[model samples]
Target: MENQEQKKRDTNKIYFLIAVIVALLGTNMYLYFQKNKSDQRIVTVSDEKTALQTELEKLETELDQANNSTTELSTELKTKDDELKAKIAQLKTALNKGTLTAGELAKAKEDVKQLRYFVGKYTADIDDLMKKNAALTGERDSLKTTVSNVKQLADNLSKVNDSLYTKVKAGAALKTSQIQIGAFKIRNSGKETDVTRASTAQKIKVMFTVANNPIAEKGSHDIYMRVLDPAGNLIIGEGGSFTANDQDLQYTYKTAIEFNGDAKTFTLDWTNRNNFEIGTYSVILYADGYTMGRGSFSLR
Candidate 1:
């Protein structure tokens, strides 16, 4: 009985030792698994941080490429670019840490996702702006070309008008022909008779015919006659200075006649206050700022 009791006590002691050993082994396994789980969590957080940082770097590179692609940016676009860069910088600052909790890593992932959306939107906006600017530039260039063409056409038309005006002005000048002069003697009855003797001549009769022109001005025309004596001096009466052939010329007599672009004959009688000289006298007709015709007569 005593041996049996001692053996039972030894068996109980062995069972207690076995139970303690099993508990210790289970505790060690729990600690090792906990440590491994902690290491895996740290590695996951670090990998997430590296991924977030890489995404941010890519975003930054994309932004730089966008900025370099265009010639100029609008004020609004520049402001947006600055805001995106600042946001990326802030996110990078947060991600640059050596470690991150699960919550922090999740927040970082969400932030990067939102940043990607914003980057896409920004790039699309830039493309749209570039397209709009290209369209505007094309329109401006086309407008300039149209204006230039219109100006060139106007200049050509002006030149043509000037040439036509010059031609018309030249075509509207008057001319005279068939100019003749005769010395006449008038009695108290005022009936003139032809005479060659200087003493017998009381007046000189001048006749001329104006040529017809289709383009001449149809109005009352003032005819100017200049009588030059044998001494090459103008026989001035109640005449004034008139411009003819770009010259300030003194005329002897002036008369008015209605002209309708038809050949017309005119006669003028001039009576000198003094006796006629026995020499040749010249007569010139001027009208419309030009010399028309000339004639000469001699008295014995």
Candidate 2:
């Protein structure tokens, strides 16, 4: 009976010990499973956080891209451009927060939406400004063209007035007729007599009759004479020059005449410095840029 009892006690003790070991193993498994569950929960939260960070970064990059065009706004819109840049900076700050809840992220997304809308409206405003600027430029160009045309018209009218004045002045000039030149022989006593022989000539006489013109100016006019030798060379006296109708001519002699619009005869003389040539010599008279008379004389 004692042995049986002892065997029973030993079996009971082994069973109890096995039950305790089994209970301990159960507790360990429960704790391990709890730890694993907690770890998995943490990993899931981290993934959500990573996704939020990625989304925030993407939204920030998009906002930056959208705001980059603000620099293109004109000076008049600089205030609006600055405001938009500030809004973009605010969005970036919100996205960069260390701990962002779902509600906060949702609010940030809402803000991003508002920013996108703002950017769209700003773009529209910029478009409107550009259109207005183009219209103003066109108007300015049209005004310039109109001003240039007006100036050209005024210049043309001025040119026409000048031409009419020139024509009127030319028409009012005095005329002359019956021009004659005579070669003369000079006596030792300074008396000149008409002669045509080269050996006997010592003086030249020029005579003309002024024609009556009702419009001629009543003034004293200086007449210039050109004497050309047979070789078409000028027989210049004292050096003198005058410009006539954009042409300059050298004169050999000059005389002053008074014009009162009445036809009158006049005579002038040139003393010979050398003996007369054997060919024909020419004489032309000019006054006030007008050819008063022309004549030629021959000597042998």
Best-performing candidate as measured by lDDT: 1
Per-residue CA lDDT of candidate 1, range 138-244, in tens? 99999999999999999999999999986687567677769889999988897888999999988888888889987889998888889888889899977699988
Global lDDT of each candidate: 0.88, 0.79
How many clashes show up per model?
0, 0
**Which one wins on TM-score?**
2
What tens-digit string does per-residue lDDT give for candidate 2 at 1-300? 999999999999999999999999999999999999989966765676566456545545644554465335677566765676687677667666666676776776677667667666766776776777788889999999999999999999999999998888776666676898899887888777888788888889898988887688898988888999999999888779986656899988988899888898888889878777889999988877867778999998
Once fitted onto the true fold, the runs of candidate 2 whose alpha carbons sit more than 4 angstroms away are: 1-72, 89-102, 187-192
Residue 73's C-alpha lDDT in candidate 2?
63
Model 1 spans > 4 angstroms off: 1-47, 68-79, 177-207, 224-255, 267-286, 289-300
lDDT of 2 at 74: 72
